[model samples]
Target: MIRITFPDGSVREYEAGVTGFQIAESISPALARSVVSCGVNGETVELNRPIEADARIALYKFDDEQGKHTFWHTSAHLLAEALQELYPGIQFGFGPAVENGFFYDVLLPNGEMIKEGDFKKIEDKMIELARKNEVVVRQEISKADCLAQFGAAGQTYKCEHIEQDLADGSITTYTQGNFTDLCKGPHLVSTGDIKAIKLTAIAGAFWRGDATKDQMQRLYGISFPKKKMLDEYLLMLEEAKKRDHRKIGKEMELFMFSERVGKGLPIWLPKGTDLRIRLQDMLRKIQKTFGYQEVITPHIGSKNLYVTSGHYAHYGKDSFQPIHTPEEDEEYMLKPMNCPHHCEVFAWKPRSYKDLPFRCAEFGTVYRYEKSGELHGFTRVRSFTQDDAHIFCRQDQVKDEFLRVLSIIQTVFTIFGFGEDQVEFQISLRDPEDKEKYIGSDEVWASAEQAIIDACKEKGIKARCELGEAAFYGPKLDCMVKDAIGRRWQLGTIQVDYNLPERFNLEYTAEDNSKRRPVMIHRAPFGSLERFTAVLIEHTAGHFPLWLAPEQVAILPISEKYNSYALEVANYFDTVGVRATVDNRNEKIGRKIRDNELKRVPYMVIVGEKEAAEGTVAMRQQGGGDQAVMPKEAFAERILGEVAEMLKATNLKPEN
Candidate 1:
C-alpha cells in the first residue's frame, strides 16, 4: 500500500501503481467524471499516469488553472491532427497553450495559406476530430529515434528542434490518432473533453520567434468543455473589442504615439499630462503620510551599476545598447530599472539602526528595448515611469513594511473602485530546480520568501503561490485586478530582497555597535504610470472620476453673445480649484452639449441668456439629463464637495 496525501491533509492508503483516475474514482463518480487532470507533488500530470509511490495529490477540475492548461494543450494536438487530415504535408513548429488559448506554428506545403474565410472550416474539422474521443498517448523516446520519426515524416522544423534543443533521454512525444508531435505534456485523457472549438486568428510568425528564421503560419484557437462556455467567451471577446484602451485613448486624445519620435514611446497629450499629474499628486500625498521621502534618479545610468546589481545579467539583452562616451571604457545605458540607483542612494551615507527603515520613493522613468511587433500602445512601451519606492529596514521589520505597502496598494485600488472581491494576490517565488536563473543564496531567498508569506498571513490575505515567477533577486507578492469586463490586469507588486543590499555592501550600525546588512523591500502600487493609465482607461471606458478627470467641467455658451459670460464662469471655477474649460465655438447649444458629452466631461454648464443675466448656469451631468440651474459659486462648491466626498469615502484625506 502507498500513502496518498490530499490537499486537506487527508491521507488514504492505495495500492502501488494506482492511477490518478482510480484515485478520483475512489472519491466520487462525479469527481472522476469532472476531473481533467491531477497534480502530483505540485506537478500537473495526466490522470491516467500511475503513482508508483507515496505522494501528495490534487485532482483538478476544468475550473482549475492546471486543468485548463491540460485541456488546451490537448486541444492544440487535436488541431494538428485536423490539419494533417485536411492539409497533407503540413509541418509543425511549436504549439503551446497561452493565457487565453492555444496557438500552433506550422509551415504549409506548396505556398498554401490559411485565411479568415477558412477559419470556420478549420474549426469544424477540429470539432469533428474531437468527437472521435481519441486517447492521447505520451511516450519517451531517445533523441536518435525522435529525430528519425519526425525526419521520416518530413517535419524538418521538428528535426531542427530535436537537433538544437532536445537531449538523448529528455525527449517526449504525444500521439493522438494520425498526429504525433514533440511535447512534454500534461494533457487531458481524450479529445472528447474539448466539446467546443473556435479558430480565432492566423498570423505570420518566425520559427522560434527569430526574425532570421523562416516565417510560418500561426493558427490561434480556443476550446471549452461546454458549448455555453464558448458562447460566453465569444461574447466577452466582443466586449473587449469595445473596451480596447488604444481605441479609447485615441478617441479621447489621452495619449499618442509618433512614428517619427519612435515606436512604443508614448507622448502624453495636454489633457493626459493633466490627468497623470493628478495621479502622481494623489500618490505623493499618501506616501507623505506614510513617512516616504521622495527622490529622483537620472534617466541613464552607468552600465557597471546594473552589472553590480545583477540586472545587467538578467535584462541587459532586452535593454538598449549602452551609450559610449568620448572617454575610453566609459559607457552608460538608458535606465532599465530604478532599484539599482536607489541602492546607491542608500549607500551614500552612514546610518545607525534607528534609521533602518528608510523609505525612498520616486516616479522614475526608465527605457527598454522592445521589438516593434511586441509593443502595444501604453501597455507595452519602450519608456515608462514607475511609482517605485524602496524600504531599507532590519530583517525583523520586513513583515511590518510589507503590511504598510499593502495598505497603500489597497487604498489606491479602493480609490479606483477595485474592491477586495475584484483583486487577487499571487506570491511568486524562485524555482528550486532552476537555481541558475536567480541570484542570492538559497538561505536568503528562503528568508525573503517566508517574510512575504508571513506578512500576507498576518494581513489575512489569501494569495496563490507560483514558483518560477519571482524576480531574479527575490520573491514578490503581485496584485492582479479584474476590471469591469472581468479581464484581469497585473497592477501592483511588492518584493522583498536581501541580495541587493549585500551586493551594494550597504550597512548600518546595529544596537551593539556592529555593522549589519539591512533588508530591502521593493514596491510599486502602480507598476508603471503608462500601463496603469492604459488599464484605467479601459476599465472606466475613458470616463474618469470627477477628481481625476482632465476636464472636470465644460462651460458652453448658448450663443456668441454669451461667450464672455462663459469665460467669466470658467474664471470663477478656476479660482475655486475646479478644472473647467470654456467651449466658445460658433456652434449651436445642442451641438456644444453633444460634443462635450462625447468628450466624457463629468459636468457641462450651459450659460444662456437667462443664466448669463442671472449669474447662474444650467448644469447637466455627463450621462444624466439636465440638473437644476444653480449660481456659479454654488456650482463650484458642489463640484468640490463631490470630489471631497469621494476621497472621504475611501478614507483618504483630500489634498488642497
Candidate 2:
C-alpha cells in the first residue's frame, strides 16, 4: 500500500496503481460522480489515469476553475472531432482552452473559409457528437511517431509544430471519437459532460501567432455543463458588450486611439486625463501616509541597464529595438520596465541596515512593442504608466513590508467600495521543471514563495496558489479583482525578488558590520493606469465615483440669462476643490441634461430664474435624479466632504 495525502493533510493507505477515479469512489459516491479531474502533486491529470506512487491529490468539480478548464479542454477536442466530421482534410493548428472558452485554428483544405453563418452548423455538430458520449483518451507517443502521423494526414501545421517545439520523449496526444490532436491535457472523462455549446466567433489568425505564417481560420467557442449556465453566460456577454470600455469611452469622450498616431497608443482626452490624475493623486496620498518616497524615471534607458538586470536576456527581442545614435555606437532602448532604473537608484547610495525597508514609488510610463493584432484599447496599450514601487528590505522585514503593501491595496479597494468577496489573491510560484525560464536558485525561490504564503496566512488573506505563474525574477502575490459585472481582472501585484539586488551587487551594512544583500519587494497596486482606468470605466459603466469623476458636477444654464450664474457656480465650486464645468451652450435644459448625462458626470446643477436670484442651484444626479435645490456653497461642501471621505488613507505603516 502507498500513502496518498489529500489537500487537508489527511493521508490514506491506497493500493499501488489505484486511479484517481478509484480513489474518489473510495471516498464518496457524489465525489466520484461529480469529479471531472484530479491534481496529483500539483499536476492536473485525467481522473482515470493511474497513480504509481504516493502523491498529494485534490479532486475538482465542474464549479471550480480547474474543473472548468478540464471541461473546456475536452470540449475543444469535441470541437475538433465535430469539425473533422464536417470538413475532411482540414489541417489543425493549436486548439486550447482560454479563460472564457476555447479556440481552434485550422487550415481548411482548398482555400475554404469559415464565416459567421458556419458557427451554428459547427455548434450543432458539436452538440450531436457530445450526445454520443465518446470517452476521451490520452496517449503518450514518440515525437518521431507524432510527426509521422500528422505528416501522413497532411496536417502540415501540426507536423511543423511537433518538429520545432516538441521533444521525442515528452509528447502526448488526446483522441476523442474520430478526432485526434497533439495536446498535453487534463480532459474530462467524456464528451457527454458538455451539455451546451456555442461557437462564438470566427476570425483569421496566423498559425502560432506568427504574423508571417500562413493564415488560418480561427474558430472561437464556449461550452457549459448545463444549458442554464450557457444562457446566463450569453446574458453576461450582452451586458459586457454594453459596458465595453471602447464604446463607453467614445461616448463619454474619455480616451481614444488613432491609426495615424499608431496602434496600441491611447490618447487620453481631457476628461480621461483628469480622472487619471485624480487616481494618481489618491495613490500618492496613500503612499505618503505609508512612508513611501516617490521618484521620477526616464522613458528610455541604456541597453546595459537591462543586461545587468537580466531582463534583456528574456524580453529584449519582444521590446522595441535599441535606439541607435548618429555620433557613436552607444545604444538606448525604450524602457520596458521601471524596476531596473529603480535598482540603479538603490545602488546610488551606500546605506546602513537602519535604512532597510526603504520604499520608492513611481508613476512611471513604460513602452512595449505590442503587436497590432494583440492590442486592445487601453487594456493592452503599447505605452502605459505603472503605479510602480520597490521596497528594499532585510530578510526578516519581508513579511512586514508585504503585509503593509497588502493593507494599502485593501484600503484602496475599500475606498473604491470593493468588498472582501469581490477581491481574490493568487500566490504565483515558479515551475520546477522549467528552471531556465526563471532566475535565482531553488533556495531563493522557495524562500520567496514561503514568505508570500506566510504573510497571506498571517493576514488571514485567502489566496490560491498557482504553479508556473511567477515573474521571471521571483514569486509574486497577484490580486484578482472582480469588476461590477463579475468578470475577474488581475489588477494589482506585489513580488519578492532576491535576484535583482544580487545582480546589481546591492548591499547594506548589517548590525554585524558585514555587507549583506537586501531583499527587494516590487509592488503595483494599480498594475497600469490605462488598464485600471479601462476596468473602472467598464465596472461603473462610465458613471465614476464623485471624487474620481473628472467633472464632478456640470452647471447647466437654463437660458442665456443664467449663463452668468452658471459660470459663477462653476468658479465657486472650483475654489472649494470640486471639479465642475459650465455648459454655456444655448441649448434647452432638457437637451442639455440628456447630453450631460451621456457624459456620465456625477452631478448636474441647473441654474434657472429662481436659482440665479436665490443664490442656489437645482441639483440632479446623473442616474439618480433631482437630489435637492441647495445653495452653491452647500453643494460644494457636500461634494468636498464626499471627496475627503473617499481619499482617506489607511495609515499603512511598517511593523519594524
535-606 per-residue lDDT for model 2 (tens digits) = 888899988877678888899998999888888888887776778899989888899999998889889998
Candidate 2 colliding pairs: none
Evaluate model 1: give its lDDT.
Answer: 0.92
lDDT for position 513 in model 2: 97
Residue clash pairs of candidate 1: none
Q: What TM-score do all the candidates reach, one by one?
A: 0.97, 0.97
In candidate 2 the C-alpha lDDT for residue 384 amounts to 96
Total clashing pairs in model 1: 0
lDDT of 1 by residue, 1-656 (tens): 99999987899999999999999999999999999999988788999999999999999998877888999999998988888888999989999998788989988899999888988888999999889899999999999999889999999999999999988998899999889989989998888889999999888999888899899999999999999999999999998888788988887778999999999999999999999998999999899999999999999999999999999999998999999997687899999999999999999989889997999999999999987767998999999999999999998888999999999999999999999999999999998989999999999999999999999989999997778899999999999999998888999999999999999999999999999999999999999999999999989988898889999999998889999999999988888799999998899889988888778899999998999889999999998755979999999999999999998887666553
lDDT scores in order: 0.92, 0.89
Point out where model 1 deviates above 4 Å.
Answer: none
